[model samples]
Target chain A: MSRIVLRNLVKSYPGGDRRATDEISLEVADGEFVVLVGPSGCGKTTLLRMVAGLETPDSGSVHIGDTDVTSLSARDRRVSMVFQSYAIFPHMKVRQNIGFGLMMRKVPRPEIDRRVADAAAMLDLSDYLDRFPSQLSGGQRQRVAVARAIVVDAGVLLMDEPLSNLDALLRLQFRAELKRIVHQIGTTTLYVTHDQAEAMSLGDRVAVMRDGRVAQIGGPLEVYDSPADRFVGSFLGAPPMNFFPALVSDGPALSVGALSIPAPSSLARFAGRTVLVGVRAEKLAVSTDAADGFLPATVEVVEPTGASVLLTVRLGDHELKVQAPPTFDTRPEASVWLRADPSTMRFYDPETSLALTV
Target chain B: MRRFALQVFCVAISLFMAAPIYLITLAAFSSRESLNEFPLPLVPTDPSTETLSGFLSSTGVIAGGVNSLMVGLNTVVLALLIGLPAGYAVARYAFRGRQPYQLFLLLTRALPIVVLSVPLARIFLTTGLYDTTYAVTLLHTALALPTTVLITAAVFVAVSPEQEEAAQIFGASPVQAFVRIVMPQALPGIAAAAVFTFVMSWNEVLGAAILTLNQRTLPAQVLSTLSFSPLAYRFAGGFALVVPALLFIAIMRKYLLNMWGTTLK
Candidate 1:
C-alpha cells in the first residue's frame, strides 16, 4: 500500500474553455479510503480518472508514495478501477473476467486460478464463477466488478459511483459489504460519488468538492460539523442544513424576518451586519412556550417519517424546519416556539457565504 | 387486430418476393423438349440435376465462381484489417481532421465506383498487378470500404467505452483492452459487417469486369458470357449467387435483427 498525492492537477479539453478538473490537489494515505463527493459535473470523477491515469492531466503531477506518476499510462500505474456500469466483459465467465489482469501479465494458470478464487471468495462470487455477466443480477454483477479489481492486486483502486446503479436496498447492503472487503485488503482507494450518504459511510475521509475544486477535506464528521463554507455545509447532509438570511442584531441575537435567535457572544462585534444563520433540523427545538432567544410561530406542516416528525414552521416570511419525535403531532395554524441550540448554530457572512470567525 | 393485419402484410410481401424466384426455378428446371411452351408451368414434370451440371461445364463459368469466393474472402480480410483499427480510432480517439476523415469516407461512397474503375485499372496495370486476385480484392475495397468503416463504427459504438477503460485500469494496455474486452463485445456486429463486405464484393460486376479479363469474378463472368449463354447456365449462375445471399442471412440470423436495427438508424 502507498499514499497517492495529486498536486495542482488540472485538465482542460482541447481548444475548449472550461476546465474539467481545475488546479486541485488532494492526498490519500496508505490504506485510506478517500471519497470525493459532489453533485454531477463537479469534476470529482474527472479527478479520480486522472489519478487512475485513464485521463491525462493538462498539467500538475500525481505521485504514488515518492514516485511521480503523472506521465504513466493507466496500465503502467497498476491502479484498478471499478466502473459505474460494472463493466464486466460479456463473453467472459465471471472467473475469466476476474482473472483478466493476471492473464494479461502472463501469470501461470494455477496462480491466476488461486487469485481469482480468493477474490471471488472475498466478494462472495465463487458460486457464480462460471456464469456470464448477463446471467447475473445487478448486485451480483457489482460484486464481479469488485472481484475483477481486487484480483488485479493493484495497490490503488479507483471507483466511480459503483453503487449508484443499484437499487436503494442493494446499494445500502453493498455499501456495508464494500467497506468490509476494502478494509480487509487495505488497498489505497479513491472513490467518487454524488451521494453524501455513501460518502459519509464509505470514506475514511471525505473530500467535498464544488465547481471543480475541493471545498473541504476532513473526517466525515469534521466536514459535517464544521464545513469550510456554505456549500460544503449545505451539501453534506440530508434534508440539508437550513440557511436563514439574517442580521447580527445587538444583544447576542440574529434576526430573521420576525424571529431572532441567540447568537454566540463572540459574534457580538459583528452586530448590525448581514449574516447567514444555519442550523440542522436535529438541532432546532420546538415547544409550546417561548424562552429567551426563542420565537413563537404557527406550524405550517408536520411530516411524520416513521421515527421523527419534521415540523415546518412559519416565522414571518422565513420558514424553519424542526425535527421532533414522530409522536409530537401538530397541525397547521397551531402555535409553536422555535429555539436554536446556540452551540450548534453555524454563522456565515451573508454576502460572501464564508463562515464567520465565531 | 391491427397486428394480425401487419403480419398478413409481411407474409404477403415475403410471397411477393419468393414468387419470381419460384417461377424462375421452375422454368430453369423444365426439360429442353418443353422449351417453347408458353404460359410457363408452375412446376416441371421432372426435376433433374443435368442443368446445374451442364452450367458448371460452361466455358470459364465454374472458374469464375471460384474466383468470386477468393475475391470475396480477400475483400473481407483486407477490409477488416484496414477498417477495424480505423473504426476504433475514429470511434474512440479525437484528433485534428477526425471529422474531415469521416466526411472523406462518406464522399467516397457518393462518387460512383464505376467512375473510378477506369482510373484504378490504369493504376493497377502500371503497378503490374492487373488481372490478379490482389487487384480484384483491392478494387473491391473501394466498394467495400465505406460500408466496412460505417458498419464497424456502429459496432464499436454499441460497445461501451467503460469496459475498455476498466481493462486499462486493471493493468491492461489500450491494445490489450481492445482485444480482451472491446473486440469480444463487438464480435457479433463485426461478423455482420464482414458478411456485408463479402456480399458487396461478391455482387460487384461493373468494376471487376472492367478491371480484369483472364481472372474474372462470378458477376463479371456472368455478364461477359450472358450473350449466347445457355439458359440453364445463366440460371445456375444466378442460383449460385443467390446461394451466398441465403447463406449470409442464415449464418447471421441471430444477429440480423440487431444489424438491421442499427443500420436503419
Candidate 2:
C-alpha cells in the first residue's frame, strides 16, 4: 500500500530515432489502479516495465512510496509483476510458485506455508496446489501468476496485458475477478493493455497513450466523454467516434455536404474555417421522421448486435454510423433522419488533430 | 500403402545400423576358433566368456578402462563448469562480438584434434603434466567444449527470460533467479550435453594416444596395441569400448528428447 510515481521517463532502443517512451510522467495513488491503454507499440508495456525495474529508462526516476527506486534492481524495488505469458515456473507446483518469493527472502517455513495457503484460497487454487503449471488451464495458470504476485505482499503490482491470452469469455470473467482481487488486496497497481474496454473496466483512472506520450488520463467516463485529442477521442470507443469534415459558417452552423447544423457558440470565432467534427455512434439519434434539425440520409447497412442495431447511413458522399435500439430495424437503401446532440459534438483542429474547446 | 513403405524403410535403416554392433557382440562372446571359421558363424554354438575374462585380466586394459572413466567424468565436469555460464550469457544477453564468439566456437571444430595434440603434448611436458590422465582430460575438455557450449546455448535459448524476470520481481536476485528458476528447467538439456561430452571423451583416440603414455584411455590403449593383440582381444576390446557409449546414450535418451522438444513459447 504505497504510491508509485514515474517522472519524465524516456526510453529509446539502439539504432532507433523514436523514443519507446517519451518524457512521460504519472502518479498512482496508494491502492489506486491506473491502467495505461493504447495500441500496440505505443510504449505502454515499456512504461510498465520501467516501473517494475525490468527496464531502465534513458532518463527517469521511479518512486515507490517515499523512496527513489530508479537505480534499484527489480528484486530490491519490492514490486511484483505478472507478465503477459503468466511466466509461471513450469517446473514448480502451484504451492512452490506462490511461495517462491517468501522462500527467496528466507521467510520461516510456517509463515510461507500460511501465506501461500491464504493466497491459494483467495485465488481458488487450493485444489491445484500440488499440480505443475503445465497441468493447469490458461485461466488457472493466470490465477497462479496472480497468487504468486499477491503472496509477496509487494508495495506495487505491475501487470502487462495479463488477460490478453485468454479467450473473450474468459477475459471478461477474469477481468472482473482481477478487479475484485486487486481491490481486496489494496496494492497500488499499474496495469497495461491495448484494449480500451479492459482499461475502462479495470482502471480507477485510465491513461490513454499514443506515440510514446500520454494522450489523456482521467476517469473512464471523463476520458470517453472529453478526450483531449483526436487520437484519444477515436481510440477509446467501439464503433469508434466518427469524424466529418465541416465548414463553420457566419451563423455558427457547421455545413457538411448538403446538410447544416447549428454549432455551439464557442466556435463562433472559427467561422468560415474548416474543422473536423467528431460524434460517437451512440450519441447520434436516428429517426424515420424528418425533424427540422435532422439531416436526411440513406441507410446502407444495418447490423443487429442483440442489444442494439448499428446503422451505416450514407449522408451524401460520406457515411455515418448510428447506434439505434435493436428493435428499430430497417432495410438498407431506406431513407432516415439523423441528428447529433450539440453538447456531445466534438470539434477538432483539422491540421493538428487536436480537440478544440467547444 | 505409403505409410507401410515408410515403416519398412525405417526398419531397414535400424537393422543396417545395428548389424555391425550385433556382429561385434557375437564375436566377443564366441570362441576364438569359431571366429576364424570360414563363414564366421553368426550364432555361437558354445558362448564362452574366455575372451572377455582375458581382456579384463590384462593389467594395461584394466588401467585404461579406469583411466577412460576418470577422464570422461573429469572432462564432462570441467566442460560444463566453463561452458554453461558462457552459453547462458550468449543466449540471454546482447553484447559486442557475440556472433563472432559463437562462430569461433564452431570454427574450432574444423581444426582436427591431431593438429593440436603434438603441441599440446609439448606444452604438457614443459608444464610437468605429460604422461598423466589430467593432460588427457584437459585435451578432451578442449575438444568437447565447443559442442558443449553450442548445445547448452541452444538449450538455454529455449528457456524464457520472462521466467527469470518473474523470479527477480518476486524478490530473488539475478543469481538466485537463475539458480532457482532457470537452472531447473535447463537440467535435462545440460544432462544431454554432459552425456555427449562424456561419450566424446571416452571414445577419443588420437589426442589421448598422443598426450598420454602409461595412463592411456581405453580407446588409445586399444589402438596402440591393435597390431600386436590377437583378433579375439580386438573384438572384445571393441565391444567393451562400445558398451559405455551405449550406456551413456541409454541414460540420456529421455533427456535428449526433452532437450529437442522444449522450444520456447
Deviation (Å) of A328 in candidate 1: 1.4
Residue range with the least summed lDDT across 10 consecutive positions in model 1 chain B: B256-265
In the range A135-235, model 2's lDDT, one tens digit per residue, is 99999999999999999999999999999999999999999999999999999999999999999999999999998999999999999988888899889
- Which stretch of 10 consecutive residues in model 2 chain A shows the poorest summed lDDT? A250-259
Per-prediction TM-score, please?
A: 0.94, 0.96
Q: Mark the regions of model 2 whose C-alpha exceeds 4 Å error after superposition.
A: B96-104, B262-265
iRMS value of model 1? Answer: 1.2
For candidate 2, give the docking quality class from DockQ.
Answer: high
Which residue ranges in model 1 land beyond 4 Å of their true spot? B28-30, B94-107, B122-130, B262-265
In model 2, state the lDDT of residue A65: 97
Q: How many clashing pairs per prediction, in order?
A: 0, 0
TM-score of chain A of each: 0.96, 0.97
